[model samples]
Structure formats: C-alpha cells, structure tokens
Target: MQIIVVGIGGVGGYFGGRLALTDHRVEFVARGTHGKAIRENGLEVKSIDGDFRAFPYKVHETLDTIDAPDLVLVCTKSWQLEEVAQQLAGRIKSNTLVLPLQNGVESVEKLTGHLDPGQVLGGLCKVISKIDGPGIIDHFAFHPQVIFGEVNGERTERAIALEGVFRSAGIDVILSDDIQLAVWRKFLFICMISGMGAITRQEIGVMRADEHIRALMETSGKEILELAKHKGVGLTEKDLENAFRAIDAQKYHSTASVQRDLMAGRPSELHDFNGYVVREAEKYGVEVPVNAFIYYCLRPMEAKSRAHE
Candidate 1:
C-alpha cells in the first residue's frame, strides 16, 4: 500500500523510515529544514533494534505535490490536529485511512468529525522517540508498537492489510478490536507522567523516589481511571493495578518532553494532555486535586513558553 506520513517528527520519521527501508511505498510529508534534510540525506533512525538509513525516499511539502495514499498517518501534536485535518482533506481519497499516532485520545474524534468516520482508523503508538536533529530520529526504547482498529469494531480489509504492512517491516503491531480502550489506557499513563513531571521540574527518577510526588502520581491515575469508568470504559481493577506496576517496574529516570518544552520556553502540549484530563475530570464531578494543582502550577510556565514561541 502507498503510505504518506504527515508531520515527520519523531513518530512519523522513525516509523516511516522503517517502512521505506523495507521497500514499502512510503512518502513523508514534512516542512522546511526537516524536509530538506530528508530529501538531501534520507531519513535516519537510531534505535537499539538497529541503526539504518533509507535513501531516495519520497518526500513532499504539501498534498498537491503527491498522489492520494492508501494510508495517511497523522502524527502531528494534538494542537495541530484540526489544521492538519483541513489540509489532509485535499489529498485523501474516499477510502484513504487516517491513523492518528499522537499522545492524546481526542485525535480520533477530531479527525473523524472533520473527515469521514469510516476513513479514520483509531491508532495508538507506544514508543519514546525524538527528532534529535534534522533528518534524524532517535528512539530510546527497544519496543515500538502501533495499534489501530475500525470505528465499528468490525474487521475490515484495509485494517488487516495495514497490519500486514507494519508487521512486514517488523513493527510490534496490535490490531485491536477495542482501540478506544487502548487509547484511554495510554492517555492515563502519559497524562500523569507529564502533569507531575512538568509541575515539579523533575525526571521520573526523582519524582518517583519522593513519596509525596509518587502519591500524587498514583492519585492522578486513579482520578482518570474513575473518570474512564464513569464513561463506561471497560477497564478492570487488575488493569489499573498493572498500569501502575508497569511504571514502577520500568525504573524510569525521565521527564516528559512537554516538561522540557515548558522549561525551555517553547509551546508544550500540556493543554491537550494534562489540561484536557483536568477539564474532563471536572465535568464528571471527580475531584482530581493533584492534577488540578499541577495544571494551575504550570500555567505561568506555559504562558512564558508561548511568549517566546
């Protein structure tokens, strides 16, 4: 299948590069310096799995420059979802599938509302990757997974074919029948980490070590889980426990990129991740005190970051 990867940031660059390396018909949609770099030197991925490069890969700056694709991976940050969706409409065919591989749960809703619901496939990516520099994607984890499903939960030809494409490239593909739950589980894990890390200006090592911070993290997770349950999400008590334990077992010593962006005075995705959770928690009358505090504390930092941006 012909694929177009939008927003060639960490997620788009790495996965698209892998598909291209394996001789898949993958085209990258990028802009400015990143686009120039990929065109001049190809896309480079540095990962524990292996380091390799794909040369002469198709790269374009706009939809007009390319043909309609079988799959369009919308990997932009949540804040850019609407704008990207508008541009995507110009290129996507009636049957073109959109897989949103961002950090939040709202992408699917936003994209599907703008485009055809059937054309938008629910997707979630679990990986720690970044664009270290122009044309270079650095992946810190060994496991890179991508999951997607039909909106109606029916197994379709494109859904299965997309899975085959990724698997042929050796990706950890989870073709979920219940993708919404997977997206929520990922949001629950990420929001807590980003919220706590941003407010405290600490990495996972220091944050998890402090009892007060650790408690806050756990509480925030519980608050979100409760909200999910209220919305009739099928998450078990064991699922909640396992989510917490997975973080503990990782022995992580890290902070989210949003925290780093806040500190560096660059616009962060806190509004979409942490801020979104806080807003949702309030509607449910679920008091997420810890998360609420984190949102308020980071307000000034986000303001400062936006001024510079």
Candidate 2:
C-alpha cells in the first residue's frame, strides 16, 4: 500500500514507524528539526515491543509533489484537523481512504466537511507514546491498536483491507461495526480524563485516588454524556463505568498529551475536548457546569500558549 502519514507525533510516529517496517510504501510528512532528523538518520522507535529503525523511508515536508496515495493517515492534533483536512481536500484519488486517529468524536464530521464523505473513515487509536527527540518515537505504555470502519457501520472492503495492512505491520487493529459509537466511547474516556488532568494539574493516579478529584471527573463526564445525548449519540451508564475502568487501569503517572502540552506552555486540544462540550451544550440548551469550568479555567493558558507560537 502507498501510505502517507501526515504527522510524526507520538501516534503517527509509532504507527507510521511500524508501517515503515513493512514492504508497504510508507511516506511521512514531518516538519522542522524532526523532519531533518528523520531525513538524515532515519526514524528511530524505542518501544517496549522492541526498538527498531526504519530507514530508507520517504519524508515530505508537505503534501505537494506527491501523487495520489492509497491511504492518508490524519495524525495531526485535534485543533489542526480542519486545516489538514482542507489541505487534503480534492488532492487524493476518489477511492483513497482517510483515517483520523485523533482523540475526539467529531473527526469524521470535520473531515467530511472538506473531503468526499465516502472517502473519510471514522477511526481512533489506543496507544501511549510520545516523541522522545527529533526523529525518535517512544512507545511507553498500552498495547497499541487502531479501530476504524465506515462511518455508517458497513464492513466495507476498504476498511477490511486497511485492517489487513495494519496487521501486516504487526499492529493490533479492529474494524468496528459502529465506528461513530466507538469514537464517542473513546472521546467519552479521553475528554473526562484529560479535562481532569488539566484542571487539577495532577497525574491520572493522583486524580483518580482523590475523592473530590474523582467526583469532579465524574461530574464532568456526566456533562459530556448529557451533551452527547443531545447530539444523538448514545452514551450509557455502562460506557461511563467502562471509561473509569480504563482510567483505573492506567499507570499512575499517566497524562494525556493535551495536559502535557498545557503544562509545558504549548498549545493543546483544549477547544476540541472540554471547550467543544461547552459550546455544544449551549447549542443544545443543556447545562455543563463541570466541563464549562474546566474550559474557561484553561482558556487563558491556552491562549497565552498559542500566542507564543
């Protein structure tokens, strides 16, 4: 398969690095020092799965100068999704598939706004990773996996073929029957935890262990659930419990990249996660005290961080 990985951050770097290990044509789109490092020394991955180097890999600074690819992995942060999708609009073959592995529920909705709806897949990835240095990726925790499917729940040939491609790289993958629901499930978990992490400025274990902090997380999660309900997304009590289960299973020091970015005075997916709920809640006439508080509290930091960029 001719694959184009648009971002070489933790999510893309690990998955794209794995694909690079295959016979498949895996090209990368990276920038600045990181792009130069990969171009000069190849991409290095330090993983619990075992360290490996994928050299002789193609790295592009932009999507220009490339022919149509079989698949385009939209690996940019949630806040960059729209701009990336716009760049991809009408640039790929009609049959090409675009999958978003970001931690959000509106990936497909956002992508379809710019590209052919049929060409976009509802997707999400489960992995704990980050860039350790220029041209280097660190897979620190979690058994990585990609789950995706047609937005309408069909077992399409393309979705199956993509799963096979991931498996060929020894990457765990799933083809969901209801991908929209799957994305919402993941969002439900990510937004709650990430919001709490930012609000408390604490790690997962610390927040989970503190009674008041844990309750705050639950309250914020319920707000998200209410907003999802109004948006026609089915989120049940069982799903909330399942989200907490995953949170509990995390290593104590765990923190989402969004939190890490904010802590380091870098721009993050603040609007895409908690702020998204606040806006939608107003649209749906639902109250979201917890999520609103989190979003407003972090807005100044997020703005100041972006100003530096």
Best-fitting candidate, scored by lDDT = 2
Quote model 2's TM-score. Answer: 0.98
Q: On a 0 to 100 scale, what is the lDDT of residue 55 in model 2?
A: 65
Report residue 303 deviation for candidate 1 (angstroms): 3.3
Candidate 2 lDDT by residue in tens digits, 1-309: 899999999999999999999999989999999989999999999998899998635899888845788999989998888888888876799998999999977788888889999899999999999999999999999989999999889998878889999999999999999888888999899998886798788999999999999998899888888888988888988999999999999999999888999999999999999988998899989999989899999999999999999
Clash count for candidate 2 is: 0
**Model 1 clashing residue pairs (backbone):** 204-254
- Candidate 1 lands at a TM-score of 0.95
Task: Give, for candidate 1, the lowest lDDT window spanning 10 residues.
Answer: 246-255
Estimate every model's Cα lDDT from 0 to 1: 0.82, 0.90
Top TM-score model: 2
